[model samples]
Target: MSESVIPRPSGAQQGRRFSLGPALLFCPGSRPDRFSKAAERSDAVIVDLEDAVVPGEKEQARQNVVQALNWEEPGLDPATTLVRVNTASSGELDADLDALAGTELGHLVVPKCESVEELDALAERLPGVGIIPQIETPRGVLEAERLAHHEAVVALFWGTEDLIAGLGGVTARRPNGTPRGVIGHIRHTVLLTAAACGIPAIDTICGALADSQRLAVESEDAAAEGFIAKACVHPNQVATVRRAYTPEDADVEWAKALIAAFEQEAGLAMDEGRHAEPTVVGAFSFRDEMIDAPVVLQAQRVLSRYDATRQR
Candidate 1:
């Protein structure tokens, strides 16, 4: 399978290798038959060993996952091929790590993480691979900043389903179906914590897989909320997530125009031979919006991603 690059969110560095890509498709550890097809649809493929398998099938599923990971992948970037292992505290984790030891698995989706010690242990065990800890429990949500900054963690994932289940309650939803109240609060906390720690935040899976419109709305909402990517249980969810995350053609054009205006303004300032303080006039504007540090970075990222996609 050939690789498809999903650009990281606005403000991320260009060509960063370990980006948390938009929309990862999950393949059950027991269902290797779906692995190839799932990879074809999503930005990345996650062969799941945790929630997807029961105790009786766990050992076989682990072996199947290992085989699939080691198999030839012509189109999938090694970094894009991930595995979601059993939790750190699960006794199965040691075996899972050992099973994946010699392969070129680039990332892992860690579930139900609530402690920095778990991340520390994972760091010691899996030396080089990227780890995206799934913050599901209240404890995990509260300790998100620590999890985000863990030496081994590449990104933080806010798992909505697990979170609600952990809380033993329901997350109220607005009439529009977006998460509301406590659910929204926890999501924002995870997002803000990741931002504070300078890591990407991946939004949890949208359960309404059959409803493309809802998925789009939710994906857009997640991106607006500062998540770099989202998890998808089914392959069909990939396109909607990609569309939501990809900078729109108009937005990309606007970003380019904004950057051009800034550059032109800087040139005019220098040509006018007017030396002013760094804070003079505050900044430049594209249309009515002020082009501040974040805006400028976002414009650059938009253009960068657009250009990369075009080149590919």
Candidate 2:
């Protein structure tokens, strides 16, 4: 993507909170058994409708997803099962919404979300489904704030390929191997928009399914840039995505110390090595803004999970 093509927000603002698991399992309808098994191990399961199902077999994929939702899989929370529907204007949109309407599934992942109006229409149809809108075009990125704030919208995921193509971005690889120009700008815009709206920000699917090393790097890169979770094209990418989202030991320790420090003095003294200035802790540095929320919570979340696991 090119810098000129990707539009930036007019003013400086805070970022958003992203909720991602170690891995989100994706089933595109090609491999049912693989998809089912992946769902068992994945942090969340996403049944895909776009880019996965053949044109002629789209209905079959929809039926498959609905059937899967009706199945009672042990240990699988229906709330964590997300259906990735086709674009709001696609032929399959109504069918997708109909299938999702009465189900126990809590999330609907809608692609090519170009405006809040589209969301309004979908929300009218579904009434109460949590919308995870995929911003995959220039118009979509520009309207991100509105989409993010839409009552139906709970999260926004960036789609690199579609947005890049929309912006006429070159496919050529940079010297470091990452795409240069327009494509990178689209990503930056997606991050900025999601941050401004205070919703979860997710990264697009990594195109390189065979290169595990590259996949790991890409996942980590998204994490560093404030993307909480990433879309997976294959089960192989789930573990990599999960590990990328997890906090390291150092992070967990820091979060624990911060929480402990604040609890001890009601926000007075942090650990000697960690706190250069006692006053910083007194101000409650960690809780002031959205940009810092993810880092702080990630650490806290890790420790909590560890504690919970140990008890069981």
Candidate 3:
């Protein structure tokens, strides 16, 4: 959890395209009835085999997930499928993997990933599957960069609820609902580490399921802070998450204009209304903001993402 304790990430592995979806919904693996509906509603349906399932229902939940995979629902697609398995510490982890063995699962979400040894073993076991290790422990935070560079890890999701519990805290948020100090800091650590390792960083799920306005604020914060996606606990959160991930129409237009301006000329003086000290790149004025290299690159990604979503 200490900034000084962070380690450097290592290398890449057998890669698969990790979708830049906005909402990664966790449909309880025990509820097969909700599986196809959640898949259709969410950008990625993360069939959860942990937390939501009781111990007595664990095996049944595993079987349900496996059976749901074979479901011929119109919205079911392997590319949007992510299976959140039990942690290595859990006695049920092996069983979870066994349930999906030899199946072409697009992604595996391994929860409570605190040990690199467990990651290495999972990588070996699920060779071609894109792995997303959820970071929720103190050990996981310190070794995040190391985990990010793991050959199997495609993205990292910061599980704030478990993280707060692990840290012996009550909540990951303030009374007004913004992320608390330590949790917010750790969230940033996970974000930066994932970015440095060239992988997507998923923000923690918003706990206020009924508060759509608050969810929008939190999702906006996540997207503005460079998170590729937000986790969803319910179907209602999906639309807001997607909206947050996708650039607003005005933002998209601004990004397009900025990109066009950059393509036209490389000058440090194109301000009409916008003002900046000028960071020595193209200084096109855009709503009173500087148009530097980073800004330009951000615009490019925004438009690129918009195009990608439209195609999908």
Q: What TM-score number comes out for model 1?
A: 0.84
What's every prediction's RMSD, in angstroms? Answer: 6.7, 9.3, 7.8
Per-residue CA lDDT of model 1 for 1-312, tens digit only, reads 999976433212321345546777888888777877887777788888898888788898888777776764323346678888997556788999888886778887788888888877776777677788888888898888777767677777877777777788765466777786789898888888877777778888888767788898888987666677788998878878877777888988787676666666655442221222223234776798776656666776676556545542
- Using alpha carbons, what is the TM-score of model 2? 0.78
Instruction: Candidate 3: list runs displaced more than 4 Å.
Output: 1-16, 71-75, 265-292, 308-312
TM of each candidate vs. truth: 0.84, 0.78, 0.84
Clashes of 3: 1
Model 3 clash pairs are: 274-288
All candidates' lDDT scores? 0.74, 0.67, 0.78
Superposition error at 123 for model 2 (Å)? 1.0
Clash pairs, model 2 backbone: 1-181, 1-182, 1-183, 2-181, 2-182, 15-195, 16-195, 22-242
Q: lDDT: which candidate is best?
A: 3
State the weakest 10-residue window (summed lDDT) of model 2: 8-17
Find the candidate with the highest TM-score and give its number: 3
Top-down TM-score ranking: 3, 1, 2
